[model samples]
Target chain A: MSVTYLEAIREAQTKLLREDERVFIYGQDIAGKFGGAFKATKGLAEKFPGRVLNTPISEDAMIGTAIGAALEGMRPIVEMQFADFSSIALNQILNNAGTHYYRTNVPVPITVRLPSGGTKGSGPFHSQSMEGLYSHYPGVVVMTPATVEDAYTMLIDAVAIDDPVVYCEHKYLYYHLKADALPKESFPVGKARIVRPGRDLTIVTYSAMVHEALAVAGELQRDGFEIEVVDLRTVKPLDTQTVLASVARTGRLLAVGEAFPWGGVTAEVISRVTTEGFQLLDAAPARINAKDTPIPYHPNLWSEHRPNRKSIATKARQILQE
Target chain B: MLQTAQRGKKSKKTAPEKPASKKGQVHERYVEAFRWMLTARILEDKLASLYRGGMIVGGVYLGRGQEAVSAACGIFLKKGDVFGPLIRDQAGRSAFGEPLLDVVRTYLGSVKGPMRGRDGNIHRGRPRENELAMISHLGAMIPVMVGKLLAKRMKGEKEFVGLTTLGEGGMQTGASHEGLNIAAVEQVPLVVVVTNNHWAYSTPNEREFACANLVDRAIGYGYEGHKIDGTDLNQCLEVIETAVKRARAGRPPQLVVAEVLRLAGHGEHDDASYVPQEMKAQPFAQDPVARTEKYILENGLLDEDKLKQMRAEIAKQVDEAVATAQQEDPPYPREEDWRSMSTDELIDKPSF
Candidate 1:
């Protein structure tokens, strides 16, 4: 039987709860049959007993409490119902959890699961990719898993991480992505994976956008071009070496992301490649992201707002020709 | 001297209690709380002077008027219990068992402090010992304290409570509302002490909140509410100790609102000329340090000679801590490790 990306997340939590007594899930509407907003925590409350708890609709307190629990040697997983709402808890996440170890030598081992990326009509508030926002802060590890295997393993690795981690699980990838079975092992976090390897051009992306890049690679393959797709599993400790090596082989780079175009993961990737791998580049690095405006509600506008396979192929074609 | 004479006359009119066995315990507790208050007062006074003399960097926030309430918040907490002290909580920090050296070293930027010279002044705490180093955000520590208690509860630890202090201004923050509500919902043994010092920085109560009293918020948050005269040591000690006991007894989270006035400016950098002279004449503006000293003398908890000796000893301790901290080297940029993340593998190597 196949496991969906969402089930892989639930399975990771199940494994963590079974193995470590220190592991506990705390979030709003995530306990006792309610499961979660997306049902990512379906049946976890019953299985773990008191290990899974429902919290008040308090994002600030959710993260603050997680930090406190982490300080006391408990690994807490806080689920923000949506990535947009995490803005309310940014102070607690960036200042409290992010700065704790630097100032006091106390590592806060808390994983904040953000249901990120845009669904068809999620609108501005519900549809947002916050990896770049969280990655801007120090002491936080930002993970964006694009596959079922990475979703399961990286979540388990996120909880094992000593520093605070923002695990951005794309809402769109919940059921759309599937795998034959959960993998026994996967690449560790902070390492990028080359989903499709080629030599003509490199398309670097993560999360839901990685699939879009892969689709673009397929579309371009019908032509004379061969494209390389590198999935950046973790955005913060970006696998610059893999990206640079891919760029060194392909000589062209196109960074695509679902987040806004303004200084996000796409921009960060292109900046790093241009700065560190200037000699490796045969053409100027390019990137494609969502429009600078807020994510729209209409499915047609939303489709156009975010980078898709068509837009990624168009951008990739231009970079390859250069 | 005139104020002391008037207080002495008032003490004479009231019957001085002989130290019975039960009263002796109460007296000892009062004296212990007073010692913390006194030490905090002396240390902050030195810090203010050093700041004025340009010997210290960063802001110096003094708990000049709110010592009674601050000290009471920490004094009742045991070893296993957690304490989250705010900017004006040096008195509480001391009573909660934080070292004077930690305070002095942080202020002087010595690398030997609890913060390792990364954070300075009131932001110092030993989290391993359940003392949370507070960030500048007000009301943020409330949720942290709740989480600490929740973790302890999950670990099957019992009889421990977590206490944190916030200002009247912090009571209106969304963090306070959310944290307090969550604590109540989870039934965590947490006590949140709000010291209504009449002003949040320069903003008065009228500008900060519309509630008649901050204690009214406790009801909405499902907390057992109590109020105290923060300048009065007897009331502060009695009310806070009771609130803490109720919380430890597994009662709903306690919210103790103490009424006082911030006698000093928000920080040493602020002159506080914004405070009207009429407000300064108010009873809540009375210095908790002097009031506690008078209460000790009035109740015969300790004699004038012993109080004098305690003050001298505390002053000497403060002086030595400051000297030792000043003699130690500040963190050198070249020698600083500067790694924020604890995971060595996750940390990115410096490109330069």
Candidate 2:
């Protein structure tokens, strides 16, 4: 079952809808008539009919409906048109969906997919990386897939988790890569994966940053610096041991993110490492992140606003005193 | 189906609901429900006394004026049925076979209480044995419950109908419209019970909703709306049973307006000075529980001599539960220990 990253996700969703009659996929312009703004859910509505629901411009209702359906033993996966629009539904997700289990012990199993991060020039309203807010909320399992395999498997895992999950897909990576047959069964959450191995430094990150870290590591290899990179697939149940162990041997750490450096996953990982991996640190831990501001419209300014592979390489050099 | 759009005035149906239950229901069950109502009333008043003392931690949201509203909606649930209740739904749970002891324990805030004392005052965690969980958020559970009812309907199961309770205060919440609108579209079985006590913590009902009756608000959603005399226990019983029966038949959703009054301050901590003096006297006339007791005596449903024994027995039961709850240790996170379970992600953690 060879497929592109985009098709891999679509295949997983299409197959799930076919196999599990209780599973539903719905949101604004997502049904077959509109085929989603990205065309990932292109033919789902025609195949499933009423099951592939098309929603109005209401995130609150869209999320609330999916939540209701999930509570009644029906598995519902809701796609927010853009990650930025999830603000309207954040109250439901933060106050109700995510916190339902810890507050009331009532299990609400639903998957919320956000076309997250930036590279495309959709402007601030349409293009924003807002995973920090979701990560800030407790009881939510957060996912930012870095590979085609992860893009496919995380959707299945998100549905299987007893708690609600926010599966953030980097929109830039939609047609960027391909892989053969993502393992469809038994994908686990809270587990990080080692994408590359080196001994001088550990590059810890997730989502698009995983690609940037890999590129930075490739350039650093010319300078005889060995970098170990681990992709933290899920941010909430952060895979601390795999990261801490890698940094313990490497003696240096660089956490990268495309989101704002302040209050992002970078800050979270740094705090964790300073506490759990304090002895392993050779130099003070550092993070490379996007400038602390709203993503702008101009292609040049947007390029400057994002933390790229160069930013990772420069930060790694600064930490290593290159 | 009676498809009229008026409130309470149902379209004249040629056939009334007659479920094929030839088992012949007992008369004692209705009497027992009346007894529970009486017990809930007296218990609310007494719980205030306990609140004033150090015996109770959180002040009770005394459902003093809305006792009959609870009684009417809860009486006839069978096994596998679920009720989504709000914070002040003591009478509703009591009607659903929840133990008096557990309710007392929850109110008294004991470690052995439901949800392990994580929820207090206005949340539901205990009484899992009855299949009803407490909805803590404001009208957030409406769509969630309707979705459940939708599932029951789609599967062609008569086993579950979502019984949801909210104060008229939360009626304006968006989830209410979303829940009711979709429930109507899909013809799902759901009963929305709004206890309009006329006060959403000092805001008048007139300020909250445009219509005088909350049931009127349900019309736009294609619901069969009813405005019942919440003070009239008999009327409440008849109307709620009708809604439940209609819901079971997949006749969209029904909105019931139970106009109630608050006999006391909202909670133990809330001062009564905020309430207007004239408003308090108005509901006293329609004091539902008092009216029911008078009717029970006038109708000779219970002997005057037997009433004394029944009151004494119920009083003893409530008092014992409260006493046991108080004597038991405070909740897992109460008193000196505000919360033993604060996650690393801090939101509302208590600090000394």
Candidate 3:
């Protein structure tokens, strides 16, 4: 049976609840039969009993309470119904949880699961990639898992790390992406994976955009140009070494992300390459992101707003010709 | 003490009657709470002097008039219970078992303090001991305390309650609303004490909330509400002690709203010229330290000679803490680790 990305997330929570007494799941409508907004916590609430509990519709309190629980030696997994709503809890998440360890010697081991990125018509409020936003803060590990194996293992790893973690699981890939079975082991978090190897140019991306980059790599293969793809499993600790190595081999770089265009993950990747690996580039490095506007509701407008295979391929072709 | 027109307005809600059987135990608690309140008052006075003398680096906030309520919030908590104290909670912190050295060392920027010179002033806490070092955001600590109680429950621990304090202004925040609702929904044994000191920084009660009283929010949020005149140590001890006991007995979360007027400016920097002199003459403006002292002497809780001895001992302890903290070195930039994340291996080193 094929394990989907969403199923893998459920399995990880199941394993955590079974093994660790300190681990508990707290979120809105995630208990009893309601499960969660996306059912990522389905069946587990019954399976774990009191360990998986529902919470009030208070995002600020959700994160603040998780931080408190973490302080009291509990590893809480908080699920934001959508990535967009996490903005309401920024004070608790960024200031309280983010600054707690630095202010005190104690670590806060809380995992905030943000169902991130755009679905076809999820609209401005629901469809947002917040990894870039959360990554800007210190004391938080931002994980944007692109595959089923990484989704399961990275989540488990996120809980083990003694700091706040923002796990940005792409809403679009929840059911669409699948694997043969959950892997016994996976690559360590905060490392990049070379999904496709090439020598002509390197495409650096993460989350749902990894699939788009791979599709562009396949399209460019028929055009007699080799394209490399690097999936940044975790964006904050950002495996810069892997990206630099890819750039050294390919001699060109293009960072792609689904977040808005203004200074996010894509911009950070380009900034690092230009500052450190400037000599590795045959031409100036480039990046592609969603238009600098709120994500639209119409399918056509939404398609144009975010980076996709068609746009990535066109950008790749132009870079190869450069 | 001068009584204003507003003094007897809320007198209808009188102090709970002291039980005849528990008179000695109640008297002993009164003496202990009084000692803590005195220590906090003296320590804050020193801090204020330090701020004025330019020995201290940050703002100095005194729990000048709110000590009666603040001490009561802390004195009732047990070893396992959590206490989240805000800016004006020094008395509560002392009663909750916070070391005076921790307070002095943090203010003096000594590296040996609990904050280790990373955070200074009121943002100091020993979390392992369940004393939450509060962030400056008002009402933010409420949810954190709720979470702590929830964790204890999940661990199958019993009879432990968590308490947190906020000002009249903080009670209006969305964080406070959410935190209160969740505590009731989970039925966690939590006590929230809102000391309405008639001002939040510079904002008055009228600007802070529209409710007749802050305690009015308790019933709507499914809490057992209690209100008291904060200046009366007897009323504060009676009301807060009852709220804590009710929570420990598995009742709904308890809300204790104590009313007092801020006896000093928001901080040492402002002279508080904006406060109307008429409002200052109100009975709620009675200094809790002086009032508690009078209660102890008048009721013979402690004789005058013994009270004097207690005050002298507390002063000596405060002096030693301040001197020791002053002698200690502040954190040096070169020696500072400067790392925020606890997971050391995850930090990226410059590969180039």
Give each prediction's DockQ, rounded to 2 decimals. 0.76, 0.32, 0.73
* C-alpha positional error of residue B301 in candidate 3 after TM-score superposition, expressed in Å: 3.1
Better of 1 and 2 by DockQ: 1
Q: To one decimal, what is the Cα RMSD in angstroms of model 2 from the true structure? A: 4.6
Residue A287 in model 1: lDDT: 89
Off by over 4 Å in 3: B1-21, B348-352
Better of 2 and 3 by lDDT: 3
Evaluated at residue B326, the lDDT of candidate 2 is 75
For model 1, residues A138-179, the per-residue Cα lDDT tens digits are 889999999999999999999999999999999999999999
Q: Candidate 3 docking category?
A: medium
TM-scores of chain A, one for each prediction: 0.99, 0.97, 0.99
- Tens digits of per-residue lDDT for model 2, A1-322: 5677778778879878888877888678888667898887898899887777777676776777677677667788889989999988887787777666665556677889999888657778777777777888766778899888888888877776667888999888888877876674644567788899999989899998899899989999999998999899887667777889899889999998888778878888888889877899999999888897889888988887888876778889998883
TM-score of each: 0.96, 0.88, 0.96
Off by over 4 Å in 2: A32-35, A46-50, A55-58, A65-68, A103-106, A184-188, B1-32, B126-132, B154-156, B283-285, B326-352
Tens-place lDDT per residue, model 3, B190-219, is 888989888888888889889887777776
